[model samples]
Target: MAKNLTTLALASLLTLPLIGCMTTNNVQPIATKPFVIDSETYQSAGKSQRIKFIVLHYTVSDNERSIQLLTKGKVSAHYLIMDNDDDKIYNLVPEGERAWHAGDGGFAGRTILNDTSIGIEIVNKGIQPQYKDALKDSELDYHPYKHFVEFDEVQIKKVAQLVQDIAMRYDISPKNIIGHSDLAPSRKIDPGAKFPWQRLHEEYGIAAWYDEADKQFFMKETQLATPTIPEVKQAFRDYGYQINSTAEWDKASRDVIYAFQLHFRPLKPTGQMDIETYAILKALNKKYAGRDDFY
Candidate 1:
């Protein structure tokens, strides 16, 4: 009996750990005490919304490579839209979790955008694949690789729907919907000039658009004198571009201008300040000022 009791005690002791492990592995919540529920009627004002911006990017490779890189590699996106004929969008990472896209960038006075933005990576080869063949015998030292691949109509439609759904859910402002190049102008340029900003704005209302009337008015009034460098820089800043507001047309300013032009004026992103670019910046600033609801 004594030996049996000792054996029973050892078995119980060993089984206790298994029971603990089983309880720990279970998904349900475990309460240590009987709890009484208390209801609080008042809501606290200390909380704020988690999501604020939506940044768009284009994977510089095919869909398979994009998936491998985004999944196994260091970088990740909340969503990935495959460049197929069908309407399919893959959710690689959950919306509630942060993705490693939009590294070292800011917009609208917000930096480190991964914490506050939902990143969507579209699977599209950014530049022309035939760039080498096209520029084989050119005397030009620099090859202006064509970065204007047309996104498939079906893919774009799916992207528009997904963006609209996310915007509605998070209350993300139209102005806050931006491209990867828009934020990290210095180091990155994906979702380049080819991505249709105007269509998304005009048709889907997912992004802010430059008012045509405002553009026409600016063009009519400023026919003779182009906007000064300082003026143009200020306008870019007012429109939430991360650029220096200086009179000198420096490299930083040029990079930001290039990014802005890629988004607003894709046909001519010369990286040089021109009347048209300045006017567009002014219109964007005027229309979107004090309207971005991020709190």
Candidate 2:
């Protein structure tokens, strides 16, 4: 009886360890309580809207790659407009939070645009694959107008809607609705020549655009004798481009001119000074900055 009883006790002890293991495995984890802060009674009256500029860009890639790059990669944007049949606009970063889209760029008198600007990345395969690596400084090597891809019609509509919405909410000036290339003329050229700026200006009345009359007046004046290179440089600077006082048509000068043409002309961005280009520059300056001495 004693031996049987002892054997029964050992069996029970062995089963007890198994039961404990099962119980431990089935145990529920305790959830942490959410933290809370209350500040309903205080507000500051001396605050202003953080957003001052809206910089636009093209992803230079397909929709999937663009999405992955903007979200997972080091670069990011406040908004991403997909180039797909679906009309989905992804807001990757919050409007209040700064995104890492504008890298080493400045616009107007402002530097480090990522601080005061909201970036919008539109998905498009920018330059064609064959010409992707071609240099842009010389038209003989690569011309953005010839190589760039057109934005989807749906994408343009979406861009207009989004820009208008943000502009209204933040009271952003039309002049502040600029391209990435406009911000960083030297190293960047995006939202390229193929972007329908004229259409946007005509149809939606969105973004900064010059009056045709103003352009024509400047054009006629420039036909007789265009402004000197130094004067043109000052005009570009006055109109908020980061240009230097280099009297000659140097590479930096050409880069800025290319950026301006990319925004205003789109068709003929030769990066060389011509009557039409000068006229457009003068018109833009006169309209936006109210500076009228083009000659």
Candidate 3:
């Protein structure tokens, strides 16, 4: 009995400090008073997600320089995919925080894209001068648009996976999965012609693309009468490009068309409204925007 009493007393003494340190509820001890957060019971139903788009880009430099510029420089992106054999992905900025990647651009009537989109920068040496020189005199004129270097196959797969994950989480529209060039056609042309948008659409089931049958149908109509410039501009606008109905094929219009062709018809992005280009545009607007009539 004496030995049992001694053990009980020792245990009581050992627990005294802990008991004294406990909160009023006696659940646990806290070093200092803490602000209580009540998250278990109530949540508001009026909230919606802020992320609406994903904008892709190419860094146009080596990996080291790409990281340096994105991290230290004025411009930044949420993610960066290096073009190395390992195909590493770096989260440069958090998705919740707005990166300065989308500057002076809008998409599908949404302006200030930086607030509503996540940007991904892939390290690539864009548009080698030798390639440009070779294409300059070729009959396959892509005048304002040039062939950008192809992304590493491994790098592209990682990009597709990242995009898939984000899009699934945010429920972002396939049409809103776009390139830097798509957002600001006049000022930017990145994730350029060689970005393999078709591959992403076909293989990964990512991004919006026109139906081949729809395109073929529109192609036949192209032989009737050429679509007017204003009509073409309106088609572009309806298809989510920030093009104006300026009534003529101006430099700005050409730039926007170049951006479009860079994504869709990369082989000959001449910035000219040919039969093929018109048909492609109409097909896209019809499929994506729910427009039945050709412009």
Per TM-score, the best of the predicted structures is: 1
- Compared with the true structure, the alpha-carbon lDDT of candidate 2 equals 0.85
lDDT of 2 at 194: 96
- Total backbone collisions for each predicted model: 0, 0, 0
- Please list the C-alpha lDDT of all candidates, in the order they appear: 0.82, 0.85, 0.84
On the 0 to 100 scale, the lDDT of residue 222 in model 3 is 77
The CA-based lDDT of model 1 is what?
0.82
Q: Tell me each candidate's TM-score.
A: 0.82, 0.80, 0.80
Give the C-alpha lDDT of model 3: 0.84
Candidate 2 lDDT over 203-258, as tens digits, reads 98888889889999999998888688899888888888888787898888798999
TM-score of 3: 0.80
Per-residue lDDT tens digits for candidate 3, residues 1-295, read 9999999999989877775566677566464688789998999877667898999999889999999999999999999999788846899899989999999978888889999899999999878756756655776534344456878998889988999999989878788899998989988878888889999999998888888998888999878777788887888888788987778888788889888998899877887778888898898887777421211
Off by over 4 Å in 3: 1-45, 131-146, 290-295
